[model samples]
Target: MEYIGSRVINASRATIANILADIRRLPEWNPAILSVTAIDPRVLVGKPYSIRAKLPGSPTIIYEQVSTDYVVWHLDGLQAHETGAWKLVSLADQKTEVTHTITHSGAIFRMLAGAFRTVPGLRLDRLQRRAEFGQERAGREN
Candidate 1:
C-alpha cells in the first residue's frame, strides 16, 4: 500500500526542510509523534533514529530507521513494515511544496493496509497545520 499527502506552508522551503531534518521537533508538528530520539546524534543523510509515538489507541509505538530517509515500524511485524518520508520541493515564487509519502509492504499489510492508509495523510495534515499556526503566531509576535 502506498499513500501520499502534500501541504503548502506559508514558510519557505528552507524552513520546512530544516523542520523535517530535525528529528527532535517532530512532536511539535506531527501529532502522531510523541518523542524522537536520534540513536546517533549525527546529521548524516543515512543516520539511524528511533522514534516513540502514540498511536490511535493511546499505545506507544516504537520505530527504527531502516535506510536513507526512511523509517519502518512493524504494524504487526508479520503484517507490514510501514515506510514514510518527507520531501520538500521548491515551488514557483516563494511557495514550498512539502510531500509526505508512505508505503506498506507485506502479505498481512496488503490485507489490512487499507484500514491504515488514512493515517499518514492525517499526520501530514496536522504537521502542515502546525506550521501554518506557527507562522501566524510569529507574525502576531512581530
Candidate 2:
C-alpha cells in the first residue's frame, strides 16, 4: 500500500527544504515525534537515525532511506513497515509544495498507517507556521 500527502507553504523552497532536510529540527515541528536521537546535523543524507514518537505509545522508528528525494521510515508493528520522503517542489511567488509518501504491505500495517494519514497534513501546518514566523532562520539575524 502507498500513502501520499502534499502541502503548499508560503515560504521559499530554500527555507522549507533547509528546515526539513535539517534533521535537528524534527521533534520541534512534529507532535508525533517525541525525540530524535544520535543524529549529526552536519550529515544530511544516506545515514540512519532513531526517532522515538508519541503515537499512543512511544516507539522508536528508524530512518533508513535518507536521500535528497526519497527518504523512508521503518516502523515495527505486528511486523515491519515503511513511510517516505519530504519532496519539495518550488513554485512562483515565494511558495513551495511539499509531499510525503509511504509504502507498506499487510492488513494491520496499512490499517495502523491509515491512522497517521493526517501526519503529513499536520506536519505541513506546523511547517507553514514556523516558516511564516521565520523560525527556520532562527538566531541568524543579520
Candidate 3:
C-alpha cells in the first residue's frame, strides 16, 4: 500500500530547502514527530541516521533512516512494517513542493494502518501549520 501526500508552502524554494536540509528542525513543524536526534553522521545524502519518536499515545520507537537527496525511513512494528519518504521538488517562481509518501509491505500492515489512513488529512493540516511557522520564523530573522 502506497500512501502519498504533497503540499505547497507559501514560501520560496530556497527557504523551504534550507529548512529541509536541517532535520533537527522537524519538531518545530512536524506534528507527528515528537522529537528527532542525529544518532550518526546527521542529515547528509548517502549517510545513515537513527531517529527516535513517540507515536501519539504509543511508546517511543526508533527507526533507521538513509538519506540520498531523498530520505527514507524504515519502520518496524508488530502489525505494520513500512517505508516512508520525504521528497523535495523546486518549482518556478520560488515555489516549493514537498511530498511525503509511505508504502507498507507487511500483511498486517494494511489492517493496522486502516484506522491511521487519515495521514493524508493530517499532513494537509500540518502543511498549513508548518507554512505559517516557517513564514513567521523567516520574518523574525529578517
Q: Which candidate has the top score in lDDT?
A: 2
Residue pairs with backbone overlap in model 2? none
TM-scores of the models, in the order given: 0.63, 0.71, 0.61
Candidate 3 whole-model C-alpha lDDT, 0 to 1: 0.56
Query: lDDT per residue, candidate 3, 36-101, as tens digits?
Result: 655432355544443444332232223344332355656554455657676766665545576778
TM-score of 2: 0.71
User: Cα lDDT of model 1 overall?
Assistant: 0.57
Q: Give lDDT tens digits, candidate 2, residues 1-142.
A: 6667788877776777666656667777777666776557733444555666543333445566454344455654334355656777777656877787766665556557667667677877887888767655564444
Model 2: residues with Cα > 4 Å off, grouped in runs? 55-80, 105-108, 111-113, 137-142
Best by TM-score: 2
Name the Cα RMSD for model 2. Answer: 3.5
Alpha carbon RMSD to native, model 1: 5.5
Task: List RMSD in Å for every model shown.
Answer: 5.5, 3.5, 4.6
> Residue 90's C-alpha lDDT in candidate 3?
64
Quantify all predictions' global Cα lDDT against the true fold.
0.57, 0.64, 0.56
